[model samples]
Target: MTDHVDVLIVGAGLSGIGAAYRLQTMCKGKTYTILESRSASGGTWDLFRYPGIRSDSDMYTLSYPFKPWTHGNAIADGEDIRRYIHETAHENKIDQHIRFGHRVTRASWSSEEALWTIEATNDERPVVITASFLFLCSGYYNYDAGFTPEFPGLEDFQGEVVHPQFWTDDVDYDDKEVVVIGSGATAITLIPSMADRTKHLTMLQRSPSYIISLPQDDPIASFLRKVLPLGLAHRLTRRKNAALAIGFYVFAQRFPRLASRLLIGAARKRLPDDLDPRHLTPDYNPWDQRLCIVPNSDLFRTIRHGKASIVTDHVAQFTKTGIDLESGDHLPADLVITATGLQVVAFGQIEMDVDGEKVDPHEKYVYKGMMFSGLPNFAWCVGYTNASWTLRADLTMQYVCRLINHMDANGYAFGMPDPTGAEGESAPLLNLQSGYIKRVAGMLPQQGSNSPWTIRQNWFLDSRDSRRADLDEAMVWTVRKPVAVAG
Candidate 1:
């Protein structure tokens, strides 16, 4: 059976839910349905079950603009975030429109019909759906598995090995010696979270990543909530946080050396005297990659209490008991955890075609950081790497709504960003130097150096420009023709 709607939204997580709410309220009477690959909502929050699974970004900015986050802790746990998304969907009655366990595999756009044909699977059975517009809210990373490098002699190790992505309940860590590999956010979070439970925990990394400490609760937000109305306080707090984040990013980019020094100095203060400061220092400057946030210096506190340690060395091989380092040192471990990284993918690895021609993302340019050039009625929701993901995602959602309303007001059948003479010197869509991003650099879309094609990561500029954007400047709009009746 085939289903059709005015709009087809992919994924039921944070961005997907937000997209639905915006569409229903702003574009009233528009028919839409959400197709989620997973059986549940809360995309990232529901999938990741590792210990210390909390958002690095503050909840105030990460939350939807329409909804006020009343949680006491600015840095929230995974379960709390999951509940928040669920509550939003329930309150807005968005849950009724979601089709769970439907994994979208292919989407084909037809300019003649001004529509899209979507192909998905529900439990190995074929399910087809059609829509006027397709919105991909699926995240960038591969959900099936995380990135883990091949370590030598892994089969020889008698102990159980685990990855944070697929952490299960049966895996025991209580009073067991554990060694977590990698130095990204996941590794840092695991080290502190598992320190107390494990007999001894050690973080083994080949290189260092910049880590910063932040308070769990925000005093300003608490005070504002007490004094002002909920809606006004939330707006003010959101703006204040956004401005502060942008200012720090600009300062770091302009003065990298000074920023690096300040970050290293702060880490040193929290770290134990015996621990080497080199372990906390990265070769690259701050903000080069996403900074790891440690709430209330939990990682440092755990290390200082002799519950955990850090090892900066290359792994030579794995033995029956533990791993041998290349620096002529062997560390004992009973359990091994690989918190390497995530496997980045474009548009949730969905195969996209326009008029039967396969769309190569690398050859295409991103229009306004959301839509693709020459692709009509399609938008992908991608967030900021330097700041909270919701900041930019909200802007994209609002802009899409505006485009839909504009098309309806006119007699336009569909609109697409014209690629002719618009492609200049292009760069990678994402501006991050992280390992995951670099791995798939040649697969994602390109961003030009000019407006509407360039992805400026500034929230202040994007928020203002989105509202006053000239929809017809680089877009090709098709006018709807009257259908003739046969005599």
Candidate 2:
């Protein structure tokens, strides 16, 4: 027997939950079931557990409009963020709709039946679910595993190798020498916290990242969160922070070299005298890959205090004793934590097909950076690539509600993106690229050649078009039924 639902949401991440919440509240009398691949909620927060794993963007803008975050630091730690997600699920009463450990492997559209056939497995037991609408909320982050480099002589390594995602409670670096790999946010976050316990910490990277320093705590943000109620505080903070982020994103995009140089200059001032600027510099501009945010230069302060060191060189190989650098040096480590980035898996690696034909998503244009081409009754909650994810995701959620209300008024069952089959149009709202965003750029929806749905990556535009704009024929995917027979 197959269970019937109005909407089948995949992956219980921020986006997935957001979609579910919107549908639950707005879609009167519609039944929706959310399938989470994992046994728990909190998607990325539930997945990654390495030391100091946290949000790079400020918490105010990173959180949803319906849900708010209260933390001393605007950039929250993983634990705090996780707590917020759990609380939101519980408070919103959305937990009952989610089935844990139910991984959706494949879904096919049955046009004849006007339903989606979703095949999912929980603990190796397969279950069939049917739904009228399919919302792919599974975020772009890899849920399967992380990328760990195959160093030479790995079998002979004496120390333990740890990954951030599967990190356990037992990884105590207390008085031990720890070496963390990768220059991404994970590594930068791990350094300070790990340094507090480890005798010494070493950050190993082949090339340096464009790292910027923000306050460990935002005074205004923290105060606002305390002074006002959650809803108002979150809204005000989101607007204020969004304006700042948009200004920075615009400046960086318009003046790439100048922005890069200014960031490089800021980084240079925080390093030791012996460090070479070029060795620690990057070939791409800031946010080209992703810029790392630090808590009041904690990583820099630790490096200056001699508790940690940043080594710039390629990893040649690994020995039984330690890691061998291309510079002909070996750094002995008691514990090696691989802060290596996650292996990105789009839509949880699920295959989508319509009546036995495979849907090559990359070839299709994203309608508004969420839904696919000509696939009505479906909406996705994918976020922006340039700025904070929730900035775009929150907007997408709001848009979904607006669309749902419009469809409900017209007595419609579905709404899909109109197919124009445009080229290079589906590319990201941002010109820059990251591993995950790059892979799915053309595969997602297109906004326009430029903002809201085009190249305008501004949160304000997303707010206006997605939330407040008129959805009159131009910006919405809508469907309605024919007039019924008169009495």
Q: What's the lDDT for residue 42 in model 2? A: 91
Show model 2 residue runs off by greater than 4 Å.
225-230, 423-431, 435-455, 468-487
Give each model's whole-structure lDDT.
0.91, 0.76
1-487 per-residue lDDT for model 1 (tens digits): 6789999999999999999999999999999999999999999999999999999888999999899999999989999999999999999999999999999999999988899999999999989999999999998999999988889999999998998989987889999999999888899888888887899999999889988888899899999999999999999999988888888889999999999999888988887877787898888888889888888999889988899989999999999999999998998989999998999999889999999999888878899989988889999999998889999999999999989999999989999888652455888889988888999999998888898888887999999898889988799899988899999
Judge candidate 2 at residue 457 and give its lDDT. 66
Q: Model 2, range 34-77, lDDT digits (tens) per residue?
A: 89988899998888887778898888888887776766778888
Model 2 weakest lDDT span, ten residues long: 472-481
Clashing residue pairs in candidate 1 are none
Error of 2 at 388 (Å): 1.9
TM-score of each: 0.98, 0.90
